[model samples]
Target: MAGSTDVAKVYERFISLVREVHWLNRISDLLSWDQQVMMPPKGVSARSEQYAVLSGLAHDRLAGNEMADLLAHLEAHSDELDEDQRVNVREVRRSHDRARKVPRELIQEIVTTEGLSQKHWLEAKQKDDFSIFAPWLEKMVALKRRVADAIGYEKTPYDPLLDEFEPHTTSEEVAGVLEGLKPALVELVRRIESSSIRPRREILERSFPIAKQEEFGAWIVRLMGFDFEAGRIDRSPHPFCSGANGDVRITTRYKEDYIPASLFGLMHETGHGLYDQGLDPKHEGTPRGFTVSLGVHESQSRLWENLVGRSMHFWRFAFPFLQAF
Candidate 1:
């Protein structure tokens, strides 16, 4: 036998789970990219169906007893696992509970609306027109409010949406932070605008070919301790990173004149990559195997962007690398 019916077999089952779930996730990647760039202008209806199917697969996988059993097994050994595996098991269960609480129809509706909202938002933003987006956004907001109600919240509808981006954060808390931030940011901008000094205007705007930029981005990711054998990157209007734990995928938009567009984005996504890479593999496919929360995930992205990308240390180590071209 490859192993006994102990933790090793459970671990083997986890491997099967990882492969199965990641296939569903990859289907989503194809749908997302096609929706943004390749699908026919008239394909929205078919595309929605396609997305719904894939989302259903992912949702079912997470909510079904299969995932639950895996989680249960892992959790039973909770005390034996190290901190990371414990965290992974915890996350697996959290996702299981959160997703199961909502019905499948609701998940399909929300995903469809968000997809449409994104499409409308892009068209509206492109035309410098809010009117076109207003109706769709209002509908989206209403639907979202319904979602929040269905999900049940402590105080406000916005918490659920915020939870999508920043788990455990409430609407009031975000508003409070914004209320404080708006004034501080405004003052900072006012002072900076009044100052005689200015940041270099065209440093990022200088012409750089997309092919070359892509190459440069790949190089930088490698330097950041990114294990390319474990992951890859792609192109999208809005860059995002996704994939199964070890097989992380990142995406970015390429702009010929703006260096920041792809270069920095890949690094930001790399932070996400590192976090996934750091996850406890022994807990893979279980609650304790994934990110703690969206907030924790965002913190990883922000840390990579600001803490690492903007640091003197980063610049010192990588600027000459950039200055090469």
Candidate 2:
């Protein structure tokens, strides 16, 4: 028997709670970025603890009774809310329902283990020793399987894991799509290998100084419309885009002998950065401002890297800059 005013108040309270959770996530993202980009090698253990504490706090805040009560009240009054409010309520409910199923300690442990695993992964990659990372990988797989079980799935255990990124999709659906595309993709690759026409691959194999590559890549990324005031690029072992709103950051790794590694990687990440910067700031801290899924998120990066960055028309304007570099 709640009136419109009560529902509005509950909606605002719900948003306030979710906003704090969102801020916690952003802080966690910053910590993770530091862990990957700037943390000293020995700092992994401490960073893992920090991640665990933060994960537990955020999970508790999201899954607490107040949040549950607010969601129930808001959901009951769904017809009274506007489209955007309803969307936010619905998205939060989905996340809350799933999160409530998993223990906060489990989430904390998973994040803590993840930080250690990342450190081990870097070591394994550098030393070319799988043994360094294999145990951690096994632990992570087991942890994630436990999470999938808690979330509940109809078919494969991977379905819940896939739903984490894709939402409303199943492994079977993804497998069927991939199965359909594999033949065509294989045929395309076969045709490319058999065709006699080939470009000079050695042109990209020239000695491109790392400093010059970074300079050139940043210039191109700026030209691609990533606002410098809002975003910047740096170096990481693997290229990625992180942060959002007024402070997006991207990273790329350079190889002195291979130009495309950093160049195209920066372009790919810049595409993601641009998308991050483009989200509506008014809806910040809410699902309405976020990208829908990983697939759609990746599409932006691939589109820029493959469709636009690789096009001859783009090369027509960009080749001069490259030659100058």
- Please write out the lDDT profile of model 1 over residues 230-305, one tens digit for every residue: 8888886778877546677788889999988888898899888888888877665555565667778878888988
lDDT tens digits, residues 1-325, model 2?
4599899999999998889888888888988889889999899999999998888888987888889999999989998899999999999888898899999989999999999899889989999999999999999999999999999988899998898899899999999999999999999999999999898889789999999999999999989999999988988999999998899989999999999999999999998998999999999999888778889889999999999988999999999989998
Worst 10 residues of 1 by lDDT: 1-10
Name the runs in model 1 displaced over 4 angstroms: 1-30, 33-44, 57-101, 116-119, 125-132, 176-187
Q: If scored against the real structure, what TM-score would every candidate get?
A: 0.75, 0.97
RMSD of 1: 4.6
The most accurate candidate by lDDT is: 2
Residue-level lDDT for 291 in candidate 1? 64
lDDT of 1 at 44: 78
User: How many residue-pair clashes does candidate 2 contain?
Assistant: 0
